[model samples]
Target: MILKSPFPAANRFVTIQATMNKTNPSKKQVVVIGGGVIGVCTAYFLSKKGAAVTLIEQSSIACAASGKAGGFLALDWCDGGALSSLARTSFNLHRSLAQELNGKEAYGYRPLNTLSLSVTESENPSRGRKQTLPDWIDGPVKSQRTIGTTETTAQVHPQLFTRKLVETAVAEYGVKVVIGKVKSVETGGGKVTAVVDGGGVIDGDAVVLALGPWSSKFTLLSSVINVHGVKAHSLVLEPRDKDAISAHALFLSYQQAHGGQPMDPEIYPRPTGEVYVCGMSSQEDIPDDPEQIEPNPDSIRVLKRVAGTVSSHLGEQSQVKAEQACFLPCTDDNVPVIGEIPGMKGCYVATGHSCWGILNGPATGAAMAELVMDGCSAIVDLTRFSPARFVKRRR
Candidate 1:
C-alpha cells in the first residue's frame, strides 16, 4: 500500500547541479495542486514512486464537491469501449484498495445491486399513463425490468475516503502537504520550474494541475487543458428507519414536476447512511471557486419532488437532512483528460472527470504514477484521455 510522511524529511532537499544552477538533480520534486480526490490520489501515487512531493490545497482538503459527492462506483458503467476499460480497471482497483488499506471501513465501501427506474406520464392523461408506460419499465407488481446488475457495484463515503487517502499518502510516503493558494505556474523555456503558491515558489520537477473546476481558468498551464464546469444540486434525505432503503444503490430517472417545472432526477443510495437525490445538470462557470457555487432554489425543489417519488420508504419531506450543490469539471467531449499537457514539458493535468471523479480517482492515480515513474501504464490505456486531443481540436 502507498502512504506519505506527515513531516518533510531532511533528505527531502535535493542537491542542485552547478551547470543547471537552480535545478535540482539529486532528488525529484513534484508539486501537485488541489487537494480534491484526484489531487490527493495523484500525490499518493507519485510519492510512492520516491519523488519528494508536496500537495497544496486552496481550502481544507476535500471541502469542496469531493466531500459532498454521492460516492457511487460501478464496474461496468462505461461498457464496451475505452472508457469502459478504464472504469472497469478502476472499479477493480477501488475494491482491492478498500480491502487492503482499511479504506473500506474508513470510506463505508459496500457492494450493492443497482436498479434503474423510469416513470412516464401519459401524453393524454385520459389514455391511462400506466398502460402507456413502456413495456420495459412495466413488470409484474413485484419487480422492475433489469437493465443491468453487478454485485460488485459499490460506494464510498467520499469525504472520509479522500481524507484517508491523503493521510495515508503523507504518513507513510514522506510527502509534504501544505495548505495554500497557487497563484500561477512559473515556467522556463516551456518547462515548469516552480509553482507559485502563498508561501513562495515551490521548486519542482513536475507540476500537476488537478484543481477540478478551477483548472478551467488557468489556460496558460497548457492550451490542451480545456475544461468546463457542470453545476448540479443534490439533496440528502434522512430515513426514519435505517433499513427503509435496500442494500442496493438504486438509479432512478423518474419524471418530476415541481412548481410547474418538469425535470428528470437521478438518485444514488450510499452506505454512509445518506441517500443522494439530484437533478439539475447545468453548464455554469464557477469562476471564483467551487465552494462559492450555491444550490439554486429551483433545482432543490425539483430534486425534492423527485426524491419523494422514489424515497417512499425513506420518509416524508420533513426527513430531508441537507441540500448541496457542486460543480463537476468536464471536457467538451465528456471524457476525463489524464495525460501530460501538450507543448508543456513537466506539466500534467488530471481533471475533467465530471461526475465520476471519485469513481475514477484511483485508476487515474495509478495511471499517472506509471506515466511519471515507468513511462507507461499497463493497466489501462490513457491515450483517449490525453490533453493533446483537445489541442488538435483547437487547431
Candidate 2:
C-alpha cells in the first residue's frame, strides 16, 4: 500500500517514503516522558495503538510516588461529582486490566468490605468516650460501626501493577523504555519535533508529557503542560498476628490527645499476606520534587497516633514496620489534565491524577489512546479533562 499524507503536496509523504526505502527518518515516534503509573499506562495503550513508543524516566520505572502509593481503589469514593463518571469508567478498565494481566500474581487485585469505626482510644478522645464498645472492635466504641460492603472496593500493589503494565507494553506491544532526564522538547511550526534527553535527541512525530508532579517543570521549558504536587504520608504495618485483623478493611476515627482533634485513619489489609497499611497525612502545595518527598517525624507521629486508634480494634498490639511519604500530582481543581497541550501541535498531556491515579490509570490510558489514534474518546467524555480547558477558561 502506498502511504499518502493528508495533504497531497505535503512533504510528509516524501519523508515517509524515504524512511521506508533507504534513509531512516526516525520511525514515526511517540516519546512519552515519566514512567510512573500514568506514564507507563499511557505508553502501554499508545504502543498497543501501533505507535513507536519510547518511555523515558529519570529514575527507575515505578520508583516515584507510583510505587509509594497506598493503592486503594474505591468507586463510591468520588460519588456524585465529575470524578464519579471518570471513576466508574476507570474502575471498569482496572478490572479489565487485572483480568488481562492476571493481576493476582502481581497487583493483588481483590474485592474488600470497608468499615468505618469510631474507637475510644485516648489518641482520638474528641469523639467522646463511652463505657460500652462495639463488639467488632476489641476497643469499646462510643458509636456503632458503620459497615460499608461493596464489591467495587479493591486494592493493588501499586508498584507491581505499574511494573506489570510496563512489562506488558514492552514484551507484548514493543514499547521501548529509556532511562534519562529529559532536558526539553524541540519544537518548530508549533509542533514537537524531538525530545532532548541526556542520551541525545529522540525525534518523534508526537510527544506526550505524562510526568506527574514533574509536569510543571516541563511546561516551564516547553509549555506542554503544568502540574503541582500534593504531599501525602502513609505507614505499612505488620499486625502482631497478621490474622488478628479481619478480612475487611477499616477506617478508624479517633481524638488526638495532643490537640484534642478528631481524625480518621484508613486501614488497608493486604490480600496476599499479613501486611497492613494505614495513613495519609496530607498538606497542600508541597513545592518539592517527588524524589525529595519523605515522611517527617511530625507526620510519622500523626500516622502512628491514627494507627494506634485503628490498631486498638485489632487488640492494641499491632506495630508499624515502615512509614513513607510522597507527592501526588494534582491540578488546580484536582482533576487530571488529559488531552492535547494547548498551542503545542502534536503534543499531549496526561498527568495530575492526584490520589486516584492508580485506580483511574487504565481508563486514562484508553482515553489517551483514543485521542491520539482516533481523535476522540468513545467511553467517558474527556472534555472536562482537556488541558486547553484551563487556558480557555482564563481567557
Candidate 3:
C-alpha cells in the first residue's frame, strides 16, 4: 500500500554532494542520543556529509517537545541577545529547508501574521463598528495589535518536519536508527567510544547528548550541565468553523470581567485546519519516561474555558481533538548548550533550547555537523552557547 502524505508534495530535492566533498575521505561514525527535531536534523546533516550516523531514541521520533511544540519561527525575535546570530541563521535555514524539502505543503510551512490582543469588558469595543478580526473570533475582544508580520514570522508543522528529516536521512543516506534507552556512555582515552543501551552496545567515534530534559538523567552529563524541564500544557481543537478562522496567530492577555489575574494565552491556527492553544507553564519534575507525562487537569480546564470564551466554535465538545503536555529543556542562563563538552573528547551536547528547539533545530543540526566533520561550524559562532560556559560560571 502506498502511504499518502498528509502534507503537500514538495517537488524540490536537496543536493548533498557539495557538502559531502568538504569532509575527509575517512568516514566517522556518529551517535545522536535523541529523536527530537535537533537530533533528527543533526543526523540528517551528518549523513549529508557522508558520515555514518546512528540515531537512538527512547521513544518514537518527535514524540516529545519537538512534536508537541508550537512551531513559531521568527527571524528577529532573538535579536540583541547572544542568540541573535544563531536565530537569524536558523530562520533563514528554515526557509531554505522548506523549499528544499517541499515543506511548503509537506509540513505546513508558510509565513504568518502575529497579533497581540487585549481583552476588555465590551464584546465589541467599537460598539459593533467595523473590525478586522476573522469571522470566527466572535469573542469579547477589545483591541488587536500587530506583533509580527509575514516578513519575519512563520510556522511549520513540527512533528511532520522532524519525521521527514529523519526519514530522508535514513532513506537517502542509509542513516541507522536504534530504538532503546541509553544506559551509559562508555569511554576510553578520554573520548566517548560507544553508547550502551538495553539491547546492546553501539560503537561510535563521537556521541551527542541531545536528549532534551532527559539529558539531566544521565550521570555522565548531569554532573556537568544544569538542564531541567519546564512543563507546558496545550490543546488542539478542530473547530467546526475552520474557514472562519484566518491565518493570524494571536498572543492574548485576557482580563476576566470579574477581576482576577490576567491569563496570557497563545493561539495558532494551522494550515491543516486545526487550532492550537497553549500558555500555562510550571517547574514540574521531569518524569522518568516521556510517555508518562500528562497535562495538569486544572490547566486543561482553564484553557478549555478561556478558549471557549474567546472563540465559540472552539468550545464545542465535538471539536476537541487533543489535550497534551510536554517538557521544554531549560538551563540556568536560558541559552541552549550546543557544543563539545570540555574534557570529554569526541563528546558533544545540544539541548536546553527551552521554547525555541523547533525554530533552531535545523541550524543547530547544520552547525553540529560542521563542528563534527570540519572541526568548526561554518555558520553561526557557538562560543556563547558552549557547554564549557556552564563550567566557567561555576568557578
lDDT of 3 by residue, 1-395 (tens): 01112121231111111111113336687888888999999999999998888777776788889988889899999999978888889999999999998997789988999988776543554443237777677677756788899998999989989988888888888777666677788666644544444335666678888999998898888988989999999998998867878888888898766778888888888999998888789988988878899999999987887778777777864387889999999999999999998888889999999989988998899999999988899897888889998877777
Winning candidate number (lDDT): 3
**Per-residue C-alpha lDDT of model 2 across residues 153-238, encoded as one tens digit per residue:** 77888888898899888788777666556677766664454434423556667777888877766643225345677667777766
Deviation (Å) of 167 in candidate 1: 1.0
Question: What residue pairs are clashing in model 1?
Answer: 3-173, 4-169, 4-170, 4-171, 4-172, 4-173, 5-170, 5-174, 5-175
Considering TM-score, which of the candidate structures 2 and 3 is the better prediction for this target? 3
TM-score to native of every candidate shown: 0.83, 0.83, 0.90
Q: Show the lowest summed lDDT stretch of 10 residues, model 2.
A: 13-22
Candidate 3: count of backbone clashes, pairs at least 3 residues apart or interchain = 2
After superposition, the stretches of candidate 3 with alpha carbons farther than 4 Å from their true spots are 1-26, 120-130
Sort all candidates by TM-score, best to worst. Answer: 3, 1, 2
TM-score of 1: 0.83
